[model samples]
Target chain A: MDDILLMLPGPTTVHPRVLNAMSQAVVNHRSKRYGEILTETNELMSKMFQTENQSYLITGSGTAVMEAGISNVLNAGEKVLNVVGGKFGERFKKIADAHGIKTQELAVEWGTAVTPEQIKEALDADESIKAVSVVHNETSTGVAAPIKEIGKVMKNYDALYIVDTVSSLCGDEVDVDKYNIDVCVTGSQKCIAAPPGMAAITYSDDAWAACENVDSHTFYLDMKAYRKSGNKDPAETPYTPSVSLTYAMNEALKMIDEEGLDKRVARHHKAANATVAAAKALGLELFADEKVSSATVTALKIPEGLTDSDFRGTIRDEFGVELAGGQDHLKGNVFRIGHMGNISYKELFQTFAAMGIYLERNGIVEDGAAGVSSLVKSYL
Target chain B: MDDILLMLPGPTTVHPRVLNAMSQAVVNHRSKRYGEILTETNELMSKMFQTENQSYLITGSGTAVMEAGISNVLNAGEKVLNVVGGKFGERFKKIADAHGIKTQELAVEWGTAVTPEQIKEALDADESIKAVSVVHNETSTGVAAPIKEIGKVMKNYDALYIVDTVSSLCGDEVDVDKYNIDVCVTGSQKCIAAPPGMAAITYSDDAWAACENVDSHTFYLDMKAYRKSGNKDPAETPYTPSVSLTYAMNEALKMIDEEGLDKRVARHHKAANATVAAAKALGLELFADEKVSSATVTALKIPEGLTDSDFRGTIRDEFGVELAGGQDHLKGNVFRIGHMGNISYKELFQTFAAMGIYLERNGIVEDGAAGVSSLVKSYL
Candidate 1:
């Protein structure tokens, strides 16, 4: 089978260099050479997080680090304010609940961003709340929360701020220190343009302080263990890491360095803008609020009378383009176009060209070229 | 640096086919195509485990699944029998302690295997023990536990049998059902010859029954979630998996299928026999008892005058052969040669040749060719 162009929320199209990096021989994780690579990678990751806090690389997916962020700092029965807006947002509460941590959920409408006022109100009502957890970009809804604003409100309280930027981070604006984030997590397969199976977390001094008070129940995801191993002579993870994935991550991060984070983020923004414009040109309504739509992904409502299978299946099988359908409650109602990582204008053009042809052939739109024209205009 | 031949216990030299498989484009984890791949991979994994019990793939290292096996089936304060002989063996106890589980440690000397009699005595003494955790292969000490014997003893007890074959499965004899293993865990980077960052766990009906009674504290390593997602229409992981690694694992498993498990185990045994014979020919003392030595890794004591740096460093820098040093208290005292995965007589010849040259150059052995001659003879 020919390679399908990945336009999903994550597991983005990897660069050839990154894929080639993974093809190298596996290295001993405890060796000095691997240690040097790990140290360099962590340094680059710290820079990407825009924080002085130490960053930890985990050998699991984004959810693993997310669980690490919560379970390490907060013990069972401790109150935490979880902002629930989309699938990813609800995950924080699920993780908290799984650990037996008491969650004070601040529910927000799907496809809408959580407001700082709501967070403040919840925190005000619960003086015992130890943390406020939010997702920077909700891939399921294509909505980016106002984390910076929420961080400001959190600064006034004793609650630590935990943020999940699994789908944003390098693809959008994220200043960890400036946003007062105590614990921030990101995944490798998203904006990093690396393969999945690895994730990273940045922990502030406050988070570490909280960790000292809480008796962590986790062994593998323990942040203190990571910090201890990471502080060794050459640095290391507590356990064996995915060695090949680390190589891929190092190469991908180097690519990000070469491209410059500012330029990379701008490219994601441009692609998102092009996708949104093209959807509008096709007379399609977006699933997310325009003001809060994500810079890394765009969610468009499926055209009236068109099934998700009709839209995504044709784009994938017939056009050789893989687009993500909506998740959870939004399934069949919305379709997402991921424009993060190494995606470029060329890929964007092809995606719209396929969508336009499909819509026009299906009689959903009069002009098959309308979406492509809007995409081209945005690039210009 | 040129490619260093990996002869470590894990992260061994991967076949070009497996490495090339990882270079494929990333796919959406929730898509049908990915689900089919996942389902096929799990089926292959179950066969490798030699069990009818369902196998679940996790996006973390072997340690993560080890934690899953313990945490999911046993609750806090539940008594468990932890068999500790080496670094990896002690890890099970640590994980149990981290989760607030009451552990009755059956301590065995390092460089030695735990006898079935010892386990039977411990379980006889403690009727409240909910589980027995043991490592099949102690990589740190190059000791392979008598799990089949232990299983016979465990059959008379109510304790769930948890075995960690992180470095043993595929490279040695492992019959999960025959051994009565309730929960069996193995790593991808070890015998499977895949990249790190993924692990598999097989759960029996008794293990699932135990899980139902316990309130699991973990979120990411929650076995129930994996079981539910894996039982889906097309089968899926609870969270996003390392897509490229999954591809690599699938290809590696296919290679295993082609080679056949019986031949693969025989090959490992041959390589191990050759390594042990060569070590003896070089006048090196085996670290672990010869009777209980691992078929995948052979540990040998360093010569009287040669420093670990002088031995391993020269072998690595001058000869480009990478071997593993001892862990914990055995550091610098022992060196291990991994003969697992897709290792062949060619790689083994190069490794022994390097060792022979280094030993003779250091005046540690009278005849430089003695070790290499033994290796060649064994292969012949």
Candidate 2:
């Protein structure tokens, strides 16, 4: 019943403009105007992906794109190299394993990042591996993998680098072109600041070529099916696309362009620095390695006297802050604070202040000092 | 832009209440409300299918369902029986073939109905067929295949029957249980009048059993994956759902309950008859066989003096009434008018009147008086 502030990795805080875009009267999907919108959107999406390669806009979640990314082109007998570190990395391996695809995993420690050398070693070790999959940003532990490094390693090994940039694309800089990613996919609700309904995927020509050579014969998630039907007439997908959601994405993209990519990235960095600084001042240990910690979500360790679940539960129930708790092995050990989408100094400061209130009220932390010293310093 | 009526089959018209529902702040996909909604929507969807078996809601167009339906269930070497009668029927066959399913096709004349005898004959001859595929309503040629009759024949056969009911589900009537359907699929934008972001699919226990026995590996669209994840957490799916679209469907389902299903179906029948009668009076012949004519889209023969493109062009440009032209091999031969979704008699009559004006202006008809008279009398 009360207003809730979402500081979880995504469906993050949707901007007012993006929500307002959905308020327009719904339009017919087959119309020329709608086609023009789809066409223009494809153009804009290409710019965002930093590639001239054709990008697909799927009206499903980021996971849907991940499914399509693998199943559409890969045959049942082929093998994929999964880079496993945290939740998303495990997710890629699990999804591939579910598809009966043979997986060669290069496992990284939970809080540590996966190195390019690991990917190269795996590729060198397994000549059967066709695609090397990794998450650019793992929301689970605030780790951002070195995509450029992995991409280079993949290039020398003749393997495709399929990156899950769901929590990182537009959060920090993703030089998709420079990185030479075969498939870089993202969801709308992350740094885009739009309500989630769509997932945008940019595929390199090699990836399209892979889709062409793919013998899996998938139907709904078939990129070839979409390509065959969509390219034929009037800028439409093989299936009916979500028109209202497309409108929201278009408006969100405009705002991104207006602010400029460099400025937006800089804004996120500023927020990350402020929040991390506040955490340090309060003697709260950072969960991820500082060098690779995500600008979008910061995983923080629970203080000596507090449990993660109880700490997060009180904040959510009382102060109405929705922070995401750690998953898998990290459960009850860490909590993530999302600074993605439309966030500001005032919002983060409020969160810090609220944490101070709850920790003090519950006798978890020593009295009011957290607010006076830790919370205010983030603004300064 | 001026308010325009949607006369296309699938993405027809969205109800205002549904649009309002989608515009509300999105709820967390993992929330209690979200779980209750996912479960309740599937339950209501089961009622539409007339089956007790659980169904999955997907965020994509009708094609996505068609593709996921085939690719995610049947293996590469499996066999399927396809009954091709209209555009959608042919599409089902193509999707099946793309998945490398060995297909036994019973080709019926376009705009004509298929006989149960044909299906029985096909099944009697080909015992290797694993499943039977057909479309309940073929939007392209305005033909509604006799699904109930087909179900009777399929019940006696060894193969499961999968029906593409994208345009017919909430418009006319579908007793998915009573009809003994295995897979019954529909889109969000059809009779439900939700936006074009979601696809609804119901699987009979037989279908579920088939899916379980089959070697399905497509992760995201695998119904079993949805079943395991959605069933595991009462309110959760394996992946993120289109939160706003689900909210929109909830509102639309309430409207369906308010206007009883039978009453709503009767409305469609009345509109169909009115449209056909009006077309006849204007010296235009119905493209579909009378017995099989659909209650949704009505395809009409382009008058001898007019081409399909010219007539459609005149209607959209001169009268602000857009109509669908024939595609593929049927181009320039017929134009279709859809009367599905949340259309009223006023809108239907206006479309008919506008078509008359366009015909008169194009010299296809001597006057608009006969068309207007027929439309009015048919309504009475």
Candidate 3:
């Protein structure tokens, strides 16, 4: 089988340099050299998240961070407002429920962003709420919520603000301190351009304060223990971390550093804009509003007469360009084009060229060249 | 500096094939190809663990498996017998304590094996004990417990037998069904010869019965969810796993299959015997009794007049050989040599040669060549 380009919400296309980094010989997790690597990675994570808060390189999926964010910060029976806008957003309530934390869902329609007004209303109605969990970018619907605005509203309350930037951290601006996010968590496979396995999480003083009197009942995922160990000289994870993934993450972070976060975010914006513009030119509607469209993944409504399988399967099996189908309730109704991580403008252009030919042959669009023209115009 | 030979208990030197495996491009965890890989890996793990029982490839450290094993099988307030022999053995009790589980410590001295009589006594003393947690190979002290004997005793009781074969699974003989172990857990970086980050665990029917009534408050580490997902035609993990690590683990397991389990165990035994013979010839005392010495890692008493730092540092800095130092109260009192994983007998002899030279230069021993001679004799 030939190599297929990854165009999913996560487990993005890793750079060859980053993938090769995983081939480095295994080092003792407690060795001095490992400590140096970990400390450097931690610093890079803080810079990437735009926060001076204490950070951790935890070995688990992004969901581990979500669970830790809820398990550590809120005590049992304490109310936490979970902002539900999409599938990933709804996960906050599920995690909270699992932890026995009382939760009230601040529901927002799928493909719509959660507003500051909604957050304010939720917090105002519940003075005893200990935390507010929000997803910075809803991957399920490709909508980036107005976290800065929500953060401003959350400042008036004593609740700890937790944000899931799993699909948006480096691809979009997630200024943790500016947003007053007490905890910001992300995974390696998304915008970090690393493989799936570990998550990078940051915690503010407020977040720690909330965990002070809490009984997290977890030993492996205990945030406090990780914090205690990570704060030591040279920094370290509490247990043996996935060193191969950490090495790959270090290389990925280095690439991000070379590209510059601002330029990287702009690159993502350009890719997303080009994808959205081309889809529209091809007579496909955007699933998310243009104002709230995620810079990481662009969701497009499936055109009539084209089955989800026909669309994605042709893109993958025929052209070797793998595009992600919609998730959850939106499955078969929409398709997603992931523009995050190491995907280049050339690759993005090629992806559209292939999509153009497919659309024209399938009679979904009259002119394949029109989509190419729009993509070129957007790039310019 | 130069490439150093890893001689630690875990994160041992990975095979070149396994390292190359890590360089495979990232794939979507939910994709069909990924599902195939997962299913194949699951079958391999079941074989590797010497069980036809259900297995899960959890994305975390060996400690994660330990926590998951306890959290999933037994509930809060359930009494468990923790066989405390070394640091890893004691962790069973620590994890149980963190989860609010009632624990009775069947304490055994470090560097000593726990007897079946001790286990029988503990179980006989407590009729309500729900589980018995034991470490098959205590990496901290290089002691392989009498699990087969302990298994015989547990057969007479209703308590579930949970064995941690983290450092022993592939290096030594551990027939799960033969031992009647209900829950067996191991890690990737140990005898499996893969990188750290994942734990391979198996559960017997008896263990699943215990979990049926248990409400493990974890969403990420829940074993039941993994079991359900993995039982699908295309096996899947409950959450996004470390795909890179899984790839490496696949290659590592393949190597084990090619080498044959019986031959692999013999190789480990040969490597261990050579190291022990060489160390004893150099006037060093074995940390664990020879009767129960582990085939994976060999712990040795640090000769007097040589600080642990001076001992291990010289081996690492001068000879490019990294040996693990003792942990906890045994810190600075003992050193460990890991012979498990992809390390060859040639490297073992080289390591002994290097250690002998370091011993001579540090005035810890008179003759360096005598150690090499002993190693050669043992190999013959």
Candidate 4:
């Protein structure tokens, strides 16, 4: 089968070097070289996260780290305010519930961003709330909440601030310290341009202290153990990690380093802009508010005549381009185009061309050429 | 740096094709092709485990699945009998402790196998025990417990039988149904010859029934959620998995398939026999009882004059062969040579040559060539 272009939220398109690195010979987890790889990957992740705080790699999907971030700090029966705008926001509440953490759901309409004022009001109403969880980028709706302002509001309160930057971390700017984020979690498969396997997490002293007070933890995902072992002379995970994935992540981080964070962010922004412009030019309505649309994935409403499966399947089956369909409630109503990671302007233009052809083939659009030209124009 | 031959119990040498497979383009977790990969991998793993029951793939290290196997069956406050013969055995107790399960430790001396009679006596003594956890291969001591007989003993009782085959599953024969194992867990990097990231677990109907009665599970490692989602038409993990590792595992399993299980097991046994024979020829004593020494890793006592680090480090630094030093109490007292997965007879011969040189350099053995010749003779 021909290689299909991945334009999903994650696992993103892995760089060739990163993919090749995954195929390297397995190394001892305790070896000096392996430790160096772990340390270097952690260091690079810290830089990518834009924080001096220590970052640890965990051998699981971003959701595992998300659970770890919340479970480690939010004790059972303790109140936490969860700001929900989309599917990921609801997931935060579910994870907290699974851990026995009491949560007050601050739900906004889907495809809309939550405000700092709303969070401040929730905190003000519940002085006993121990933490606040928010998603920086809700992949389900392509909406990125205003974390910087929410962090400011959280500062005035005693609640530990936690953010899930799984889909937004590298594509967009997220200054951990500036945002006063106590726990920042991201996955390797997103903007890091690595295959899915590990999630990188950074924690502040407060988050660690909160963990210290907890009586029990899931041993496999224990944050304190990871922090201790990961900070050793030569860094190492407390348990056997996904060694191949770590190698891939190292190569991915190297690519990110070479591209430079600012340029990478700008590149993602440009691609996202072009995609949105092309979608609009094709007479499609953007699902997310223009101001808050994520720089990683763009959600567009399904055309009246086209079913989500027909549209996506045609693009995938005919063009060999894999675009993400909306998740859960948004399924069949919206489609998403991911522009993060190793995707470029050329790929975006090609994806748009595929989208246009699908639309024209389905009799939804009169001229496919018009959409392709508009996409090329937007890319310029 | 050249690839160091991994002679550790795990993170073993990955085959070239397996590594190359990892570098393939990322696929959507929800896609049909991804589902086929998942289903195929699961099918292969079920074959490798010799179980007709369902097997699930987890994204974390083997330790994660170990925890999952135990926690899923044993409820909090439930009593479990753990047979401890070495480091990994002791870990079973610790994992149970972490999950609030009361464990009765049936400890045997290190470097010795636990007999079925001992397990039977323990089970007879404890009628309240809900489950029994045992390590099939004690990697730290290179001892393989008598699981087939122990499984028979477990059948007399109501306790669910669980086996940790992290280091022995494919290298050694383990028939889950024949052994009546309720939960069997193993890692990808061991005998499977894939890079670490995932653990494969098989559960019987009895184990599933036990899980149905338990409330409140660690969400990320929740077995039921994984089973449901993983068994769907288009198989998918509840969370994003280590897709790269899965691809590597698929390729590794394909290699195993081509070789045939009997041949693979025979190869491992031959290599282990040669390693042990060569060590004896060099005047080094085997750590485990010869009757129960594992076919995957062979532990050998450190000679009085040579420290473990110096001996293993010299072999690693000078010969680029990474051997594992003894873990925990056996540290600086024993070193292990792994002969599992993709390791060939030639590589084993080379490893013995390196060990012979290290012994001669340390003045522990005279005429290093004598040991290498013995290894080659034994291979013949």
Report lDDT per candidate. Answer: 0.91, 0.79, 0.89, 0.88
**Model 2 stretches with alpha carbons more than 4 Å out:** A98-100, A228-234, A303-309, A368-375, B71-73
Per-residue accuracy of model 2 over A66-179 as CA lDDT, tens digit each: 877776556767899888889888888887886777887888987789888887777777798889889988999988888877777777866777888888777787877788
lDDT of 1 at A374: 94
Candidate 3 per-residue lDDT over residues A224-301, each given as its tens digit: 999988988878898999998889989999999999999999989888888888888888899998899999998988
Question: Candidate 1 vs. truth: CA RMSD?
Answer: 1.4
Candidate 1 total steric clashes: 0
lDDT of 1 by residue, A266-376 (tens): 999888888889899989899999999999999999989899997899899989999998888888999999998989899988999999899999999999899989987
> lDDT by residue for model 4 over A1-380, one digit each (tens)?
33798888887877778877877777889988899999999999999888889999999988899988998997789998998888888888988887788999998999999999899888888889999999999999999899999999988988999999999888998999899999999999999879898999999988988989985558888898898899898999999999888998899999889999999999888888888888887788999999999999999999998888878888888888898998898999998999999888778877888988878877878877676787678766
Quote model 1's TM-score. Answer: 0.98
Point out the higher-scoring one by DockQ: 2 or 3. Answer: 3
DockQ of each: 0.79, 0.57, 0.75, 0.76
Candidate 3, which CAPRI tier? medium
Q: Give every collision pair in model 1.
A: none
Cα displacement (angstroms), candidate 3, residue A244, comes to 1.1
CAPRI grade, predicted model 4: medium
**Residue B60 in candidate 4, Cα distance off native in Å:** 1.2
True contacts kept of 3: 0.83
Most DockQ-accurate candidate: 1
Candidate 4: RMSD to truth:
1.4
